[model samples]
Target: MPDKYEAELPDEVHELLAAADKDREIRLTRAATAENLKFLELVRSKVKDVPLFWAVTLLSHPELGQAASSTSDKEVFKYLTDVELVQDAHDPREYEIVFHFKENPYFTNTELRKKYSLPNGTKPAPADGTITDEMRAFEAIDLEPSSMTIEWKADNDLIAKHPRKLNSEDDEIIDGDIGSFFHFFTEKSDIMSLGGTIIDVLAEPLEFFANDPSGFDSDFDEEDEEDEGSIDLGDDDDEDEPQRKKQKKERCCHP
Candidate 1:
């Protein structure tokens, strides 16, 4: 919106617009989840190599691939069949990330999932409403932190296999090596902050795959010429009349 138009709109209207946008976002998240699930089915049936495709897709992306710090970490990724972010239909903030895995020597479990539920404040209501202060206070309390345990096979724990090699002088990990990617599951303090990184990749895997290792598209041509020519039709007095009528009708119908 233009600054002038924003200044003209009342605060109540802005609040209503924000609420509408949040509702629309929930709908969009559900739609995307359905489409992604459908694509997963297609991938299971049609894709010749599910494990390899997933491994490469993750390793290809520069940011996401950082999770796999070692060759062993990359090797474990080959067992992954599918990874997806499933958002709650009613609550957009509440979601889970699931990784479907084939039976492998690395882990006993087939699926590893991390669920999250960030609180959203209570809805505003009339003064006479039944909502109470105690209810609001209960809702405001911070929920328990989310965590996932990766059941690694004996002698196959990735985090243990690849310990952080520290610098001799400062006792800090050389080159900021955070050990194996499996540490993501072990993070107890700030899983939400760490989950954001994985969530980003799950949200749009295709976009990350398209950019690949260095966030560059080889097929793109930046030098392509754009047509600058424009044809101007002579002004007509009736041009604004139709738009005005449309606006008037919308206001009449909505109001």
Candidate 2:
């Protein structure tokens, strides 16, 4: 946005972006269990008129968040992105996901496990443990973006073997987001802040997660160009116009 549309956009938009990037959230609009998805869609469409940057509190769509919170190893994305998998500092044996970029850091490891097994192989009480990984993760992070942070002190392997819990749902989402996130920054000339200390994460090669490591679908570019003009935002009137249904109407933010 800064490179392509900045000059053309009004100064008001610029200020909006600046304020938005500074804003933060710990959760999305959290409703009852049944209304979880309903509230999520509410926020996504609510910000339609607002600039994308102005979307300060929306963390995930109901679909993504709900799906992410599940405990199964479902496919989170169609592919993966390059990343540096590290161990959380407080729990150096557990996990951490640090984007390869110097400035960008993704979610931490302890956040991904749904229900970790205690040393005695017992699920801790809610009061004793935190909701993590799979479906619980979605409910926690997506529902409460304002309460969460990308950085975590972490629970060590003695706390739980996070890597062994491999659900792949967060894996997919995290990897894809890493790719998409850096794709935006890489387009720009540069940014500041260097944080490579995460290299001490596992000392092994980064975790591999590309379903199509061979890039078999790379040739679909022709299809992408062909479908470009065929697509239109108006294609989904129901999604754009909330009033069409009784339903309804939303990021954590940063520089």
Most lDDT-accurate candidate: 1
Off by over 4 Å in 2: 1-81, 88-92, 100-255
Candidate 2 per-residue lDDT, tens place, 36-57, comes to 2344245335533422111111
Model 1 poorest ten-residue lDDT run: 246-255
Off by over 4 Å in 1: 1-8, 48-51, 84-86, 119-145, 163-175, 189-194, 206-211, 215-255
- Looking at candidate 2, what is the lDDT of residue 134? 31
Look at candidate 1 and give me any clashing residue pairs.
Answer: none
What lDDT score belongs to each candidate, Candidate 1 first? 0.51, 0.22
Model 1 Cα lDDT, one tens digit per residue, 1-255? 665643466899997786666555445654665665566556446544432555555555444455463556756776787776665433334456677789998888788776655545644332453333332333212433355777889998877776566556544557655676666565432321445556555544555444433322232121222321111111223221101001111000000
TM-score of each: 0.56, 0.16
